[model samples]
Target: MIRNDIRALDAYHVPDASGLIKLDAMENPYPLPDTLRRTLAERLANADIHRYPDAAMENLREKIAARHGLAPEQILLGNGSDEIIQMLMIAADQGACAAPAPSFVMYELIAKWIRRPFTAISLDEHFNLDADRFLQVVSREKASLAFLACPNNPTGNFWAADVVERIASDFGGLLVIDEAYAPFADRDHLHLINEHVLVLRTFSKIGWAGLRLGYAVGQASLISELNKVRLPYNINTLTQIAADVLLDHFHVFDEQATRIRCERERMQRALAAFPDLQTYPSQTNFITIRVPDAGQAFAHLLKKRILIKQLGGHALLENCLRITIGTPEQNDQVLEALKELFK
Candidate 1:
């Protein structure tokens, strides 16, 4: 029999990623160029399958540390950024309390999974963090773990950095910053890693989505505790090697990210011209737009085989749709489909 919390929990909803234009998940739609794919295939062709992965993920950790300009001791790798979130909640709650928001789904889900007392602070109408409100609730409740998504999901807007820093300082608990979308944004609190905060990042967005690699940068002491709870061999040999290879070629993806940023700006500007639609300024790779009758628009896009994230019931995001920036051609197709729908 399932635990009461497990039974009461809403099932995690993942859409059918089978065949549409597939933009719903905030994934990089560009496939690896032929040369990179061939290199990866050749590298994996000789990987030692019989042996287990390095439990410490030493090499991958080093690569991440070098890229982020931190020491290896400051980084803790995860199966994905999701696992880093779970690890932080477990470490902070220690089987007791977790606090997230109405916008982020994982913090609540994971808290429930761990059977912790979870509380949600609602966001303002613009999907911005109500810092005073959030701090007020956390202070009164004395929650030990707080999860905030910068450039928050579904809404695609970055909450102010100073506000997050204030929370971390004032709240004597673990403050987790899920920066899964940070690369696309202009501001970040990575400098806050030295402070009372833990930052999570993933290769999934940059260009290594299939590798399922994510990591947390925080104080060494905190990272060690998380390491203690993580499953041994959690990250496999192939993933470790693949991540190392990609990190070596980091500039390839950096160039791609630059192009995506350019395309995202252009897409946002173009979408703004359409009447009856309000596109939110995005710091991440995606943009969230308030459409007139989002359900009808979502369904209409589906019919045109153009998929985007529908944020119908998400607190301040009602009637909003999130669209990830794809390659130039893919973006053109999405814009064309929208024009057809609204024309």
Candidate 2:
């Protein structure tokens, strides 16, 4: 038999939206412009498949570091942020790791997988950090790690900077500011980094989901410690090329991010006009709205072939539906579907 703990847990589930207007995952719905795509294809076609990936990945690291204004030695790349989180978990194998309840679930799940005791401090009713409670619990647990998702996933709002700064200053363990949605957020925690703090960012949000590139920034000593546990060749050659090309053309991605941010605001304003649905303001690319009956609305939207996350099961998300901000026509379709359901 498998380990009892492993046997008892449900695997992370990804829904099959084979033919639906898929918006469940917080992903960029945009595609690369045709000219760029062709240019990228040419680059990939000529890459050195005969050799292994850059063992140091120095070129990609330099590009990202220069883009973010960090020293290349301060960076460590991951297949995606998940593997980076895994490395942190392995390095923090000394004690419990904590995050807010109703957070990005992987923080808890990965900690549990590694058998590190995990704590999920509950967010307040408004889904903001209960800073005092958070400080108290993590201190009590002598937590070895803390993962905070900025413009936090599922609920989608930024935790206050002052409170996070205290956690950075006071926590007994490593603190990770998971900024998977930073391209859309107003502020970042990189400036707050200390020896114990790391900031995670992913290119997935900027139309690079297929590339699976996420990197972290921290002090050289901290990053080197985390890198010790990283599997060699964790990043593939093709992915390295793709990421570098994408970073070189970051202006194009920036334009797309600008558009997504604009659309997120427009979607938020529209969600506000719904009498029956109470929507929250988000600093991320999606909005969560409370429906009178989320299950029913979720079902009706499914019938209409629109896929969004219905988060009724989590205590914090009771009657809530998380809808990713899609393209303009896609948003129009979602609005019409919701209007029909509100009828």
Candidate 3:
């Protein structure tokens, strides 16, 4: 029989986005160029399916590290950042897992699966963290691990560097700075990595979602410990080969991200012009807005074959919808749909 907690938990839901414009998930809207797609196909075709993947993935690690100017020894791979989050929770010292409320949900959900205590420090009305208060809770709860999503999801705003670094310096525990949106952000905090701090990232949002690849950058010893908890052959042979080949052409993804950022700005400006909508400035490829009626707007978009993430149930995010930036045509369609609803 399953544990009562496990039984009581509701399974995570991924709504059917089939036949919709498909902006519910924050994915790169652009597809690989035909040439690159053919190249990747050729590389993947050469992979030996009979053999297990490169468990250590040394070459891939070196390639990823070189991009960040870190050593291969400092890298740890996971099927995706979610797997890495679970590994960190499983390997950390026995104590509470902490994070700011209204941030990523996985930190708390995975902690619960492990039966670890979880603490959420609520953000202020403006969705900003108070560093001093966060540390106070972490210390009082004796939290041994924490996760902070940079340019936080759902809200799509980056916290001040001083605020984040202060928590990293004062907290006596493992701290993960998740930079899943780093490619779209104006800054990164790799310089803060140390014994108790790690930066997590995923290629999913950057256009390799189908590959399910993620990684962590930390001090060599810390990464080594997290590696112990990773499942054997977690990344398959095909994914490994594809990732290795794709990293060589990372400029393609970078260019796509630049275009998304530009679209995000354009979308922000357009959304702000609506008198009934309140838009938050974003540093990621998504924009979150508080609309006059989230339900109405969401339904309107769906009727028009569009899909977006409606983040309800949280007081701070009430009547809010998170819109992933898409190509020019997709964005234009969204604007037109909203205009029809509000007109």
Candidate 4:
């Protein structure tokens, strides 16, 4: 039987996006080029699916490490960042877990599943983190693990680098600086990694989300410890093949990211014209806006066959809706719909 705590928790919900514009999730709006897709198909066809995946994934790790200027030994792969979060929760010392409230939900959700003590420090009214205050709470709770989602989701902003560095240096336990949105951000925390700090990244937002691949970089010893808890063959044969091949054509994804960044700025300007809405500055590929009525705005967009993330209920995110930057046409359609709704 499941524990009572597990029973009390609601399962994670993913809205059905069938036939809509499909912007509910922060996914890349572009698909692989025909040539690259065909190449991947041929490669996948030749894969030895009859055998298990390469458990070590040495080549893939090396490719990823080279992109970040690190060694393969310092890299650890996971099915997705979610699995790595679970692995960290299980492998780290047994004590309280800490993170900023209104950050990544997985950090708190995984902590709850394991019945570990969890503490969430609230962000200020402007969604800013006070480094000194955060460290004080971590010290008081004696938290053994912490996670920071750079350019945090739903809010779509990053804390100052100095603030993050101060906490990373002061905290005694393991600190995870999650850069899931780094591909779209102004900077990353990779240089902050040392004995007790790790940087997490995913290819999902840039592209290749279907492959479900994510990796972490840290001191070799820390990665070695986390590797023990990782399930064998966690990344399957198809994914391994696809990721290795895709990294070779990384320029395609890099160019696409540049396009998205440009589109994000254009969208920000368009959204600002709406007097009824307040838009937050974003370094990520999405924009979070506060509207007069998020529910009505969401429904209005749905009527126009668009799907977006409506982040309501949270105190800081009240009346807020998150829209992933899409192709120019897709973005135009959304802006038109919003203009109609507000008019």
C-alpha RMSD between model 3 and the true structure? 0.8
- What is the C-alpha local distance difference test score of each model? 0.81, 0.88, 0.92, 0.93
Q: How many backbone overlaps does candidate 4 show?
A: 0
Model 3 misplacement above 4 A: none
**Model 3 over residues 1-343: C-alpha lDDT tens digits?**
8999999999999999889999988999999999999999998888899888788999999999999888999999999899999999999999999999899888889999999999999888788999999999999999999999998987999989899999989999999999999999999989999999999999999999988999999999999988899999999999999999899999999999999999998998999888788899899989999988899999999999999999965689989999999999999999999989766
**Count of backbone collisions in candidate 2:** 0
Candidate 2: misplaced stretches above 4 Å? Answer: none
lDDT of 4 by residue, 1-343 (tens): 9889999988999999989999988999999999999999999999999999999999999999999888999999999888898999999999999999888888889999998899998899788999999999999999999998998987899999899999999999999999999989989999899989999998889988899999999999999999999999999999999998999999999999999999999999999998899998898989999999999999999999999999954699889999999999999999999999776
Inter-residue clash pairs, candidate 4: none
Model 4's alpha-carbon lDDT is 0.93
Per-residue lDDT for 217-249 in model 2, tens only?
999899988889889899999999888777778
Better of 1 and 3 by TM-score: 3
Give TM per candidate. Answer: 0.95, 0.97, 0.99, 0.98
User: For each candidate, C-alpha RMSD in Å?
Assistant: 1.6, 1.2, 0.8, 0.9
**Candidate 4 wrongly placed segments (more than 4 Å):** none
Number of the candidate with higher TM-score, 2 or 4: 4
Rank order (by lDDT, best first): 4, 3, 2, 1
* Selected candidate, larger TM-score, 1 vs 4: 4
User: Which residue pairs come into collision in candidate 3?
Assistant: none
